[model samples]
Target: MCQRGIKVTHVSKGSSSTKIQRFIPLANGLTDNMKSFAVFLLVLRYLSVSHGCTCMEGPQQFPAVQIDAGQGNVVMTDGNNYAYFLLGSQWYKMGSLNLKHVSVGPAGIWGVDLNNRVYKYVAGSFVFANGESLQQVDAGGDGQVVGVTDTSTIHCLKSTIASDYRKQSTLSWTTITGGLMYFSCSSKYGCWGVNSLQNIYFTRVTPSTCGISGWIQVDGLAVMVEIGTDGSVFVVTRGGEVFQRQGIDSSTPQGTSWTKIPMPSRISHVSYDRGNLWVVTDYGTILKCLY
Candidate 1:
């Protein structure tokens, strides 16, 4: 027996879980032969592994301007100099630091204050992470942090503390060559950034360096880009549309194409993890897309 075309089945609302199944047919364009059988099997396997995922709305809303998610936590700044962290579906006010941007990773959380000073969250308080002022900061699950200055100069935080040492020391900041307006990194996928021109760039993590390559222009204008711990990529366009990459693997370093995820019309920021996607609207509504 042979199927004829691709068919997708999706469940209606009110279900606890949404299940999607994709089927491919071989009868329409192929002759009745063994070759068609083999092709059909391969197509079935591919479709099963790569079905499109969708987003689900979250419970709470906030006046957030920036958001980040890590293994066990999510954090965001409320644009009024206050920050909040989500704990098991409930959001709690962390403090009033007047931060411009914030990020969370496996090691901890990092943020830049209104004056461009970078700080690390330790033991429920913000501690100065580096001396030099930065315009923005981002972190990775492996304790890697990177920042950019007002002049677009790039800097990375290098830990002087030993792995076995219990006491921690302030991280040393070093400047890199490239200039960027926004920067993000994934412990597994290296780093990515957008320059002043809104052009996107990617770098692979290597033993010696963060192998930064040249910038590649993508379709549509992106205001922000975020990478998940597993290398999943998401971007929010200036027009308030959210787009995600077709795959989460690091093999596609340049990310040639994207599929627009159906979301609110005024999304301003986005973050991703292994299980869910989070976004903030221009009016400060926080929503999550669960797969």
Candidate 2:
């Protein structure tokens, strides 16, 4: 049987009240778990169009130190430095490699271990990437990849090596001006990063040549930055608060202003790709948000 006219109120800061009406189907032999999942989907749909965005509890409960999502694939690293990949709703451990940060994009899957060692996924295992040490790495660009060394030195992967990194004899990196503690690049709008002081910066990157111009400081403070395939930008503050960049198009690559997204807990990191937003909380709890 289907229950009609279920009303849910939308109330959050800076937003007016709105009613979400949906038909919830309840039938015989409907397990409690299934019922809960059904409600979750309904709420997710409602929040997607609400003021900003609200992330609901997901099926995944694993504690992740960092998370990345691309296309429909998700990857993350635990506090113990172990890597895991998500297939459907289950997470599978990826070999025995320990990675502090991981990224997936058009270039492929790349990560850096605790020692800042670079590695690439190949043959179901993470192989050593012949490149300089990088504390953090991102491969979200079309063929553009960028990373930050322990000294905060920024580096961009050479286009030639990025195209055929697997078959390349040696990987090369071009050092970019300015230092950053965190960086993320997008195929549509170039790159954005945060310095040690938490100052946000953006630059137009030449993905085809792996070249970047002078850094332009953006107003605001962020501990981390992530870019979506559609040029959507997101950032996590030191207080675990999250914000999304609005009005980002060809004319306004940097966007207009920040729109706060409601969260259940303090978030440490976030990655947005396709239509899914993956968040890692301060305690390592991972959440997948549909926005």
In terms of TM-score, the best-performing candidate is 2
**What RMSD, rounded to one decimal, does every model reach?**
13.7, 8.2
Off by over 4 Å in 2: 1-54, 59-61, 167-169
Q: What TM-score, computed on C-alpha atoms, does each candidate reach?
A: 0.74, 0.81
- CA lDDT for candidate 1: 0.65
Model 1, range 1-291, lDDT digits (tens) per residue?
001222323435733132212222434565554444334333332221113453334545345677899785798888577778888887777776778888888546888898898777777877765457898888753565777888888876653221111323455566677778887777775677777777777675331333345445555457678888877778777788777765445576656677777653368898888677887866565666666
Find the candidate with the highest lDDT and give its number. 2
Query: lDDT value for candidate 2?
Result: 0.77
Model 2 TM-score, 2 decimals: 0.81
Question: lDDT for each of the candidates?
Answer: 0.65, 0.77
